[model samples]
Target: MRHLRSLTRTLHKQRIEGVTFHFDPHHQHELSTAVRHFFTTPEQHTPLDTPEATRGVFLLEGERKWVLKHNRLIHWKKQLQNYLGLKKAFGLHDLTNEFINLSAVSAKSACAPSVAAFGYKGRFPFLKEEYLLVGFLDDHCSVDDRLIAHPEQASTLLPQVFDLFARMLDEGFVHMDPHPKNILIAPDGQLRLIDFECCAHSVIDHDFSLGFLMGYFFHYWIKRFIAMDDYRTCCENYLKVEQPTLDRSIFMPVFERFLTGKVSRTTRYAILTSPKAQAAFKAQ
Candidate 1:
């Protein structure tokens, strides 16, 4: 996997005026004409989407819609390069496909529309990804979207979310991004984890530990700023939930692993600011 450290090397070699010739086998006929027009005489390469790549929405026949994410390397924005690199190295497309397959295999009745991966199609050094289309939840709101209206769900959602984390961990995969935006709740109250862009495989316990630590602190961050009591209740309640399962004292060592800076900045912030997190420090 290409870590983000190599971002500079690729960025320095970029030629705003130069173009690297390549071909797409899947859309050979259509992409050939389109790409040639973008990079013809004058050798001008069309600018890729900005920091958060342009999310192109195209409606397919029969109500199926496609969101085209042109994950390409462009010289103008440095951030796009890093995001694209991570997206490719981690094989997000494959992971998501497996997630969809799991939903089918498990035969879970929850309805979030199993994510379908259309397979990643990218040219080396240039990334362009086409995601497998799914039925969009028009009425169902993301957990993040719901929080704006119902802050009270913090008490209700956080603990349940921790349970979800524990379950995923027990299942041997870490849902890397634990933020509310990636969780979608249907009208039936079935919460589905979406966007497995940063997941990884791990031993069952380690995966659960990492996920639990991630969940514990993630909610604590918001709870601290807006709802302190809820945050405390969440921590205390989680301890209650986890206590009967194991040594009842293993949450800290698991948390310290993520604090080492390998995790995302938001995650780090969440861990550092958690109220119960200090117990881990005092223990050391």
Candidate 2:
């Protein structure tokens, strides 16, 4: 039944006002052919996500790639989970709001992929998906990727990672998810953040609470990314004279203990399923 539904599924593209594209060469018309191909050539798509009835694929644009993030109905198991209160309900994916949030956080610490084109598919209430096309960023890679290739790089990158999170908090922005894969190291050494689906920015971002941000990003970063020996350096970078937000006596021990209690991000990212990535992980 689901297969039949998929075979006949129709997409209804929508246009929203005030939305902009990062690609300058009229990305909409330019992407039309590629978008059509994406729907038609299912076998060619390099699967980027899990078991999903809705599609998510890499759309090509000449030399570059873009992410076609489609939001569609959840599976019956997921629906059952929601009904049983065993999991949170999956919400709608609104590309327009995501773009606005991206714009707000640009240049602060990280960035979302520049949206090339986006819209809704099918009717709204159900059996519909809202999607956006964003460029597959080049000249950079995720922090986790960098670490997997060179575990030794952890020492240097971990401190910069902490600083980036701290900078975001200072600049009135709070990212709900700054996980290793979501944080990228740009070519110029600037950190770029992706995945703004759960992120936010505000004039008074502190309403989200700096303490929670610290717990969410900083200490969590330690357990996931920073090694035990590197904790002091990250703490120092974050609590230097210019930014005297937390007391040394309070912050250092907490971070050290956090490091002690959990595996660093470097260790966790060291293991990979891909032979190439695993070989790189071993090479370092």
Candidate with maximal TM-score: 2
lDDT by residue (tens digit), candidate 2, 107-127: 453354555655543331233
Q: What's every prediction's RMSD, in angstroms?
A: 10.3, 11.8
Candidate 1 lDDT (Cα, 0 to 1): 0.44
lDDT of 2 at 106: 57
**Which 10-residue window in model 1 sums to the lowest lDDT?**
8-17
Error of 2 at 53 (Å): 3.8
Clashing pairs in 1: 118-132
| lDDT (10s digit) by residue, model 1, range 93-142 | 33323333333322342323443222233444433443333334555677
Model 2 root mean square deviation, Cα atoms:
11.8
**TM-score (C-alpha, index-matched) for candidate 1:** 0.54
Candidate 2: give the clashing pairs. Answer: 12-122, 110-193, 111-193, 224-265, 225-265
TM-scores, one per candidate: 0.54, 0.62
